[model samples]
Target: MEQLAEKSKKREFVKHPGLGETGIFHTKADGDPLPDSQLLTFALAGNQNCGKTTLFNQLTGSNQRVGNFPGVTVDRKDGVIKGHANTLVTDLPGIYSMSPYSNEELVTRQFLLQDKPKGIINIVDATNIERNLYLTIQLMELNIPMVLALNMMDEVRENGGSIHINEMENRLGIPVVPIAASKNEGIQELVDHAIHVAKNQERPGRMDFCDPDHDNGAVHRCLHAIIHLIEDHAKRAQIPLRFAASKVAEGDEEILKALNLNQNELELLGHIIQQMEDERGLDHGAAIADMRFKFIKEICDATVVKPKESKEYARSVAIDNVLTGKYTAIPAFVGIMSLVFWLTFGVIGTWLADGLDLGITWLSELVDLGLTAYGINPVVHSLIIDGIFAGVGSVLSFLPIIVTLFFFLSILEDSGYMARVAFVMDKLLRKIGLSGRSIVPMLIGFGCSVPGVMASRTLPSERDRKMTILLTPFMSCSAKLPIYALFTAAFFPRYGALVMIGLYFTGIVTGVVFALLLKGTMFKGEPVPFVMELPNYRMPGFKNVWQLLWDKAKDFITRAFTVIFVATIIIWFLQYFDPRLNAVSDSQDSLLALVSGIIAPIFVPLGFGDWRISTALITGFMAKESVVSTLTVLLGGSTASLSTMFTPFSAIVFLVFTLLYTPCVAAIASVRRELGGKWAVGVAVMQCVIAWVVALFVNLLGIMMGWV
Candidate 1:
């Protein structure tokens, strides 16, 4: 330690590089050029629920994170292959086709074209090869060096199906490696094949999908004509000629815009396409689709052994009869979610939190004793026992409640039940001007509104995305659970589960009402057509579920220590000292109390006019978790003390207010990112106004009914 400190003592300031003086840094020996800044990356592209993420995790080990839904990988994540430090693999959002109907397709397609990755790793579910390979065909058209990871091959074999690997490889003109990503089977060979193919710069060799004999040579003639005409344009735009031609044939506007064809060239292209459509007896788009499907059919006929429907699939169908049948699905969804809340708040999570709270109380007493015995400074001693422990410790006990709630949510998601929820809710959601896809972001909102807002990107239409973004914060995120858990435990212990479920129901009901209001006002158009494929129900992967749970728990604990910890210190200092920075005899005389008192009148109609609760609500703009911790500090060190502050009626009103209010600063910033500054500000102000009005009405109704 002394030697390290002595060495640091010899350090001196260096000149800034911006001043044309080189800073103290390593310089290249000789005239060797600097290495390329871009890492060698392989795009991991695949359909939803085809084990693309699992393969990414296996390849990257601890370097990946996962979101809940299959089709909702709203962000692009990249990681280094475990053994290949010089190479990177990007896990793009799960996409079915390169068409621009949705965000995933646009993102994956744009990343492939624009980012210029070295290669592509396309994962296809071997059990569903025919459908999966439709995407495979589209990806091949990108003309990038590509390898196909045929995932879930073990399942294919178990279900009595097989593939002629060599024949498939020959037909597709790319390396095909069968991998069971879930089982870690065939991973290393897959890695070697991927690395080799990427290193070789080997693009797909087959571009001729046109069957000149079958289409009367009409479609083939059109594609060839378009390719030759726009060959220079494709080269200028840096688009693969084959890919650009096919997109032009399909009337892809984005590609057409990028190619920037002149009026004369456009007229010639349209004439060619019209002639092909007339000869092929289909529209231009349909004719192009027919051509590709014909090619896909030939490949399947030659290389795939169709599986007899597996028992797992049969089971999924039988379960769907009950869970997804028209009459049963909604009731089933309601019952299941209610049961989850009950288990989390009424039983498992509650028991765990009680035990943890007891432990924290004991530790706090021990620390209190030691500090008093040491003759610590009185104000400092109070801060230790009351500020840190009472504030942070109280909120920490509710960690299990958040984890437990997400545990069941993660199960629903991983088991493919959530997709069914979107399907069942589609008919109802459309009436409110949102699509079935909007339900996903809202469901994800229960965990945290930031990801929920991000998840809105997966929606197909701008109107749906904006409306969903505005309503996601009304879902009562898990961060707000600490507030509900603390309040219900203090005031409604016997019916705590009922209160918890009621709160969730209230958030949903509120969002629905807001969605309706939005439909009639800012957004009047119908939701974009909802199209989703429900993956066959299967047992949730234990590792996938556990990893999600671990991530959620770790994130909550981290916030408690960092964001909440700092907020506690600032809050304690504010509530301890007066305007002049002198110690106050009573908390009501402190700076926070004086400032919050002025704002307390705003909540007078909602029945919570106390400066302390108002102050916690203000700090809640920082993080919802700060509410419980702040209340714990301001009221007293004990839950029992908290119970004395609010009457039952007022407590219920407070819960309603918190349930419907705007989310924390992080979530608002996410809204800003997804929408814009105006929408973010509008959502914040609108939600607060709604919360106050609803809370006021509840208080008024209670007083009229003599319940207050």
Candidate 2:
């Protein structure tokens, strides 16, 4: 009877899977002690042009951000592996070492020690093994379990070098995985092995400190002394003894600060380091680094195997030579960018917009037919067809253009050429106190300023990030393209395409000039160094490209429906309510006209101070697209019929104002969120003042020359 009762009770206690144990597999029955498995946080670290991010993205999928260059990843990035649920990979700022060489290095070291990730996924460029392994050795000393992912394996094999993973594993006492990150080759296995090592399924061994008897004896001795010192310090600090010790031996400043070393110990350590440097004719810190590389070379020699030939490897080498060529790079970059914009605006964009316009017209007719069939009154019919369909639907009719433009940009970014563009543009950008990475947000700004402003969150420094966000609105958004197209076609039909291109470039120049002026006066700061990971060229996945297009297109359409939808209604009311009854005669009696008239005197020097132009500027704060809508309402028709849009002076003045005015409300809110209350207020006022001044200057010059 007792056994029967026990069996019955046990039958009710069958274990569940997900809540059962801590590891990848279940280890015990219900109500057992929690397992020892943990979420292994691994940071992918490497150098510029080393494919570090490609490897990171390959491991993490699309679960990462393309942040600013040189310390943009000011915080840790965590992404869960699809296959290994317990593993969380972190993509750290690419750095040459864990030492506090720059802001980027500081971020990387701080996360490794302070944040205490489970393991370090040190990505090394196989083609540049000699240089890359320098960072690998520094990581090894941190005493954290690490896996060296030899990324760009194809490049290495093509460059006539081989990495023996088994030999390296045995020598370093850690797992070493070879992968071509861009090709998505060997990524799954790499993540699996990383998880295994992180969860203690496989454990890393110690790095070989180098043989002591050769001419490099002093190098070995310095490393030995540093290791012992670190171990002793770790014991008192009560941290992870191995990582803590390695950091101390490596002379990590953050670690020293964390330890709160006494003056005497600090003085003694300094004296020891000085003495070592004097006696060995080498810095103790540098000597230890050399020993690690020497050890890495020895291990690499024994383990790696290579085939007789690698065609992919050869192609990568050939392309790098041409792409990075001193004379060829810039022209190539400019030509490509120009082509993309030309095709975007002149060919693909127009075709898509026309097609969608036809569709929207057809839809409007269908709605009209339904209303007539119901015998709706004329006022009701006009409200349904003219107000809703003609007004709102007209704005929404250009969805195809937005979709096509986004698709082109998405492909460029995913193909890894976007980084190349940044690299080539770095020389020019640095002159203006901006890094090459600023181009990413600028490109995004062309789509919409809201996202462009948000993209600045990736910038490493608060000042630079704010500056980039503030100026991004100057980029000519896709909505502005139609305005440019209309004016150019009406005024300079033969040169419409060229004039449109010129307007876009004008925005670029203004942004650059403004950034320089701000840096020189209001936002002075040290020039942040430029270091970027140039991923190997790879064929972008069709699925990835399509998904990006869909997301961006959907966002554009959603905005048109919500923010633009509400703004249109508000604008209609402003046009409808005319206390003076003057709008019906001169189209300026409406409330919008009253507001514009009040601001007209301020724009008198620009010569074109009509209430219509003034009201467009006023409504622009809601959204740039609203500028077109307000102008259409004021003129009582489409801008496609306007003749003034094409004069050189008027075009110049218009572009200047468009580039400098206050950004949309959403962007202003983001700025407030990033910069806090007072600074946001400051940005709004400063931008408006700047816009008025520049636009006035151009307008006055045009009138004096009798060109307007």
Candidate 3:
């Protein structure tokens, strides 16, 4: 027992790279201590879709984990580089600038200013160096030790562009490493240089963009003057003077407050900023932007060469003409999504699920027979065979469907088609009061709602963030796939693909209506203009696709054994016992039925009113996958048995109710964490009310059409 406790303690102490630990080797296996200076921490930062994440994944492989920033919902991905023992790498949320314009930007900037990682790896997209370098210039001003990781170098080369690496390194006054992160090319060299910079505490030598003496040097002069004024404050606050000066020149209110300057100092700074704007014939923001772009242009001219257009660029342009065209893009997107659903539900996933179901059924029967032969206690036999096996087996059987959906979704994301989907949908979404950026979180919600809700942090506006979080749950996550598969297989087996697609679209349409209502009422505001990059499409790597599929499968399996497994036991116990804990032959006499009976009538208007159905929905609040498990245990784990509880129309209505109801507890917790408890509780109660109304309408409409 002591040894077991020691082993458990050891397991708990295994360093989690994703949480930004250097390593689990402060003390050797033999207990000799190591120096703290040997440990190094580096931050990886870049714009969205710049291959920063891919590089992080390559560096860390399976050693990373996702965590939240201190007070924000943005994800902080941390990992330990393989073969680099004393190094910890933190992957910051992707942001275009270090300015606190959005939560993501604030999170990234706060980490750099406060936590002060040993070094920075500013990943720049080689194909779009001009825009990417804008953020790089900001990082350089932070005065941190940094390396330029020019990712997607292969794409740049293939597009007939070339970068003079030596010239770039000399010009930036930092090491330049060209890497195609997706292909795992030049990654080791990049890491080596980054570690060298961190260990030596090497800061960038050149921070000035436009020289103060240049012809159009108003912005530069103002920046330098502000740096001198705020030098003491910046030093006291442990912020880089150059960064603080730039923000001050840009008239950032947050920087002004943080500096806590006196009224006289504030008036003097305002006068200087206004004078600079007058001299530059632009606003402070524009003046700063113009200077940055001017510097970027100069750097590109010196180090970057663009050759004739390549075949891949031409192909992508030709494809985008239709894929993002005004008339065809929506139809193409819908058709593509429909095909994804068909492949998942009607063909590959369904076939695989059938085999798994049979295996689970056979295993259950074998367990039952073995227990009977051994004369196991009847109650124990029921608990093992009927409770655990029936419940967990039902959820596990839908693993293929979840994996298949995620596989295709990951392919779309990797191929760059998903970005185009956002672009195409931006116009329609605007009418419904959301920008295309909202779609990123909604699409992610299809995989899981927790990250989906957290992804809303990327929105620049609080209203958009809250609204996106509210609508995210309507996307029907993969966890709900088991419930859909179960019902479709039982009731609409012949048209399974069409039915599944309809359910997804129903969720989407429901979200759109609610978004319109919210936009017109409580959250009255126009969506900010949508701006996003469309990366060149490439064939997704098989390894990357497999990795994503494996992640989805692992998460699904883990939940089945943990949350769902425990919930099943509790539910089974409740269904098998009375209030006094005495075994009850009939479930109607059990505590679960009596408790669920109160709420069962609320769903009566939606066609499913049985205590068993109500119990499933209650357990579903714990985890959506539990809905299928609860039904399997209560209905004897057979489609035929489930069929006796509802007609075809009523089954469809029940599926609708499940689709539109409040998300599971984990997602609600995420919502609370991101948007506060009031919003979280409001979302839960609102979803329940909406689901009831929508299901009631569907049931009434179906009955009027004589479909039931």
Q: All candidates' TM-scores?
A: 0.93, 0.80, 0.90
Tell me which residue pairs clash in candidate 2: 163-304, 164-303, 164-304, 173-205, 583-589
Candidate 3 backbone clash number: 2
Q: Candidate 1: which stretches are off by over 4 Å? A: 1-38, 62-71
TM-score of candidate 2 to 2 decimals? 0.80
Candidate 2 per-residue lDDT, tens place, 1-708, comes to: 223212211222112233211112211222322245656778778875566765766776754433223323435667777666767888887778767766567777767767767677888877667778778876765656566778878766765767666556555666667888767877776776565555542323453355677454654454445445554565576555444534555577767776666787778667656665666676666655665666767766676554454555466567868776789887777676677666766787767776777787798789889999999986457545644555456556556656766777777776666777778778877788887777767777887776677667666577767778777878877666545544554566556557666767766777788888988997887656666766556566565577667676676677667766676666665665677543344445677777778987776676567776777677778776666555554444344535543355665677677767787777778778877878778778977887888788777777778877
**Which sequence of candidate numbers ranks them by TM-score, best first?**
1, 3, 2
Decide which is better by lDDT, 1 or 2.
1
Summarize candidate 3's per-residue lDDT along 1-708 as a digit string, tens digits: 223212312321122132111111111122222354577899999887777777788888853321111111257878888998788998888788878877788989888988889889999888878989999999988877788888888877876789988677666767788889878988887777777667756667567776666546788678766876787887787777777888888878887788988898888898889989899899999889889998889889999997667666678799999889888898889888899999999999999999999999999999999999999998898888878999999999999999988888878876778889888888888998888888888888888999889888888888888889999999999999999999899889889999998999999999999999999998897888777777766787777788788888999999999999999898889999999999999989999998999989988888888999999999999999999999888876665798778998999999999999999999999999998999899989999999999999999999899998
lDDT of 1 by residue, 229-292 (tens): 8878988999987789889999999999999999999999999999998998999999988888
Candidate 3 similarity to native, TM-score: 0.90
How many residue pairs clash in each candidate at the backbone level? Answer: 0, 5, 2
Candidates' C-alpha lDDT: 0.84, 0.65, 0.82
Best-fitting candidate, scored by TM-score: 1
Query: Counting only residues 3 or more apart in sequence or on different chains, how many pairs clash (N, Cα, C under 3 Å) in candidate 2?
Result: 5
Worst 10 residues of 3 by lDDT: 19-28
